[model samples]
Target: MPTVALIDYGSGNLRSAAKAVERAAADAGLSMTVTVTADADVVRRADRVILPGVGAFADCGRGLSAVPGMLDALGEAVIRGGRPMLGICVGMQLMATIGREHGDHAGLGWIGGEVLKLTPADPALKIPHMGWNELEIVSDHPVLRNLPAGAHGYFVHSYHFVCANPAHTLARVEYGGPVTAAIGRDNLVGTQFHPEKSQETGLALITNFLTWNP
Candidate 1:
């Protein structure tokens, strides 16, 4: 069975995420063992890694950093080992070089970018870009396989990632403007929405991740 490490850094919707991944694996007919853990050893041995985060960027970054050897373990498994990894919502934002949520907070810097508050062109559009939005697939990636253009995903965030490399951007959504929805670089992928709460669209993405080789 393939092992998946759902890092428990005291943030993110842990239960929902685990359930989603497990279900995706089952739906895809892939035998996968999903472990929601903070253990560095477990993370190091994981075939696939998932980092999910909810709440403020600074708080999530601090919480992830609080874990002893957790970041190092992730680096070993994802960066060095070249294992496939996924980041969701604020988890994805944490992959940026820096986040300016409460203050100037550093991120994982896996993808060269900055997390900034979403500035909608229309004044009426709310701050927190909540509810369902259609995805505009910008690039082709294995994780996006079987997913249609304009697939709807659940989103609840006020900030967005501005990737330094435009080629890394996989998908975008229209709010008041083009808000980044997904990013990808080699084996790393991140989404600014909750796949667990995204219904069929989310399930397709989750399934793809489970079966994706890289």
Candidate 2:
């Protein structure tokens, strides 16, 4: 049994994430407990942390910082304590150095890079990059161990991670052009797609995260 913590900061689809974890755990033959709380102690005690976010990048940044001691707790839990952490959607964007959407804003800096909005040099691609897309895997990471290349996943975001270290990118998806879809470094993993909305493949990804040993 792995206790997965789904962070809540008055943003994004917390309920959906919780349900997805529970459902996936059942399918994975594992026990999972999901909850929404800013309790630093709870976050520190969690086996895996799942950061889910929605809304503007700037707003999510502020919401994360507003959670009292949560920021440090999360940092210590993963960086110092070596607990596994996964970020989804805007949650993924927060792992960057800065987000250039709306205005200049700082990110968690878990990985080098800045978050950038999807803007194609060609006018054919759409803005939000909504719907399903394939993850063109580039590296072998624990979080994506069994996941096949070209796996179709759900996406609903206007921004994506522009990793400074391209090596950190685990998968890339075509959206107007090639965009980062997933990234991983040690115990940290992030997904630009909503795994919760991505069905079986998504569940497998979550299972890998829970079972992976940092």
Best by lDDT: 1
Model 2 lDDT, residue 23, Cα: 82
lDDT of 2: 0.86
Q: Each candidate's lDDT (Cα)?
A: 0.93, 0.86
Per-residue C-alpha lDDT of model 1 across residues 116-178, encoded as one tens digit per residue: 999999999998999999898889898887785569989999999999999999999999999
Candidate 2, residues 1-214, lDDT tens digits: the string is 4568888887879888888888877888887777677788899888889899998999999998999889988988888999989999999889999999998998988899998888977797788889998788889888887775557889988888989998999999877679898988888899999998888779888878878887
Clash pairs, model 1 backbone:
none
TM values, all candidates: 0.98, 0.95
Give each prediction's root-mean-square deviation over alpha carbons. 0.9, 1.4
